[model samples]
Target: MKSPYSAKIVQPDISLSICGYSKVLEIVSNKWTALVVYAMEDGVIRYGEIRRRIEGISKKMLTQTLRQLERNGLVKRVITPSVPPIVEYSLTRLGESLLGPMRVLNQWTKENYSLVEQARASYDQAYYEE
Candidate 1:
């Protein structure tokens, strides 16, 4: 009954080893992080453009999200010397690597949105209506 994949798994010492994945999840799982990443998918974009594209994201939230992404090395920030300094944000290679999986997830959400709405309606009728 031994699992074939068990040999491939490395057991970590819980006391000493930290889960790096949870840290990544914490970064991407923020309310506007994924949207910000998606907004930058089409090459370098200016701050105002990102704000305009992602409707309803407050200035504060977008700024914080970009800072976190930059801190995580997933985003690159470029500053141009001009009368008014121009700032642009673009995805790093690491950020680009996440695009495929993010796109898949986005597709799944688009495909399943109606099913999810139906499920929510059914649940509400079953619980709230009674």
Candidate 2:
């Protein structure tokens, strides 16, 4: 089964010119990054909370995403003094700046979700439904 990624091409010039796109490609390109961001959208959340909210994200992946997002200035890491040291992840003001585009993305997904499901159903029916 050839997948869409098999057709995904790397464009050097465009990748270089568009810093915003490059930033997205650099940070959110990871499978778990957007999900992690979405998880933190409501408010500041902890590691365990985020991990539980987003299913199937391994500890390593979540850790790496958090670090990358932190490095990208989109997320801030807070460590508290507690019985066992509490760590929380929150979006920085810079991260808050992404709200508009993220909201737009969410709206687009919501609006087109049914269409995607239909496409997937048709594709699955054609390919593997037998």
Candidate 3:
């Protein structure tokens, strides 16, 4: 199937813009980055809560992902004064901008996942099954 935007997508401007797009993809394409960002979509959340929300993510992995996101200016980390020093995370304006694209992709997956599974099965049967 041909995309409606294929003509525009193939233009020189797209080549010029790919460098910036690649950088964004490098950050967001990390296995845990999108999950961590989604966890804080509603509002400010603490470290433990984000960990709890994403099942099977290790403490170290979550911490590393959070730090990377903060470094990229996509997440804001605030430390509150307390005996234990509570740390909270929320999306910066740049991070909040990602929600729309993510939600659209999520919807696209829901609609097309069955087709993907069927294609994978066909490919496996052709090559892997012998």
Candidate 4:
């Protein structure tokens, strides 16, 4: 028997999938990646400063996130030949291009998070009452 609520599933066109949304999300969806990008967005910064700016991120996680960003061409790392070899991180042109969209999403979240919380609360209340 067919359910009334069941709807036909349609696959998205491959042409509409530019660069693969999942591939991009896989890179940016990590909890630490966005924070790390925002940390260096202001200017070139050292590894230690990035770790300090983002609270609760472990050293290992920070290192991994930086490497992933670098690997994706979104972040650039420069090592100065010094007695201790100073390393700095900065956003490349590609990374800077992402800022505009990210800012829009950030603004949307800031504006709608309260509404989302209210919806969640209402849903939970009704769900529990049932």
Candidate 5:
């Protein structure tokens, strides 16, 4: 059976360049972008909530990352004209589409974390400890 998460493949077009792939990587590969996306997986959330959920993310970085995600059309920002002026953020349909691959990547990281740690230890022992 075909995997539900598997993307449909189209015939390769040699006329098109790989530049778009690099641009996407530049957007999603930022340090906080993935985490921000993951945080929104639950549903709509406020800015403070996102900041609190993502530990170690400074106000500036979170603000910048959110703006970048918005610019990329991956996230939506909503504002309420209440007395306190509430601001909320949520993943757009485009952003939701990314969750499948992100989940797979997250699982791979968890499964290989120990092996990665071992490699790091061996590398340090071979180089830094010598």
Candidate 6:
């Protein structure tokens, strides 16, 4: 059927099966999502707290990440009427459940960091040396 704008792009059956994986990649593969997941590991945190704990993140990026996380139902935004306003973010049950995979990824990264460093050093020494 014809819609308003552009034609559709069709794919093979195998490609269709990969859509689930693609969604997972889209959500968790992001830079800030990982950080937000790790931050929520301990418990709930206010918006400002999430910002403060994870450094080098501008307000725009922080807002974007939070929205993405919320969209995926991996995080919840709580707002309470208070002086100067109060907003907080916390993982939902679904988000909390992701702790296992997220933590595994974190552990793997930490454990393999030394190997990665060594590999980078070796590569530099072999190819980048004067």
Q: Each candidate's TM vs. the true structure?
A: 0.80, 0.72, 0.84, 0.83, 0.81, 0.77
The TM-score of candidate 2 is: 0.72
Arranged by TM-score, best first: 3, 4, 5, 1, 6, 2
Candidate 4 Cα outliers beyond 4 Å, as residue runs:
1-19
lDDT of each: 0.90, 0.88, 0.93, 0.90, 0.92, 0.86
- Of 2 and 6, the candidate ahead on lDDT is 2
lDDT of 3 by residue, 88-117 (tens): 999999999999998998899999999999
**lDDT: the better of candidates 1 and 3:** 3
Full candidate order by lDDT, most accurate first: 3, 5, 1, 4, 2, 6
Model 5: ten consecutive residues of lowest lDDT:
9-18
Best by the TM-score measure: 3
Q: Candidate 5 residues 32-105, lDDT tens each?
A: 99999999998999999999999999999999999999999999999999999999999999999999988998
Q: Which 10 residues in a row give candidate 3 its minimum summed lDDT?
A: 8-17
Candidate 2 per-residue C-alpha lDDT over 1-130 given as tens digits, one digit per residue, 9 for 90 to 100: 9996787676644645566777577767788888998899888999999999998999999998999899999999999999999999999988888777878988999999999999999999999978
Span of ten consecutive residues with least summed lDDT in model 1: 9-18
What is the lDDT, from 0 to 100, of the residue 28 in candidate 1? Answer: 82
User: Against the hidden true structure, what lDDT does model 2 obtain?
Assistant: 0.88
- Model 5 misplaced stretches (Cα beyond 4 Å): 1-21
**Candidate 3 displacement at residue 89 in angstroms:** 0.4
120: Cα error in model 3, Å? 0.6
Q: What local lDDT score does residue 95 receive in model 3, on the 0 to 100 scale?
A: 95
Q: Compared to the true structure, candidate 3 yields what TM-score?
A: 0.84
For model 1 the TM-score comes to: 0.80
lDDT of 6 at 79: 90
Each candidate structure's count of clashing pairs: 0, 0, 0, 0, 0, 0
lDDT of 2 at 115: 100
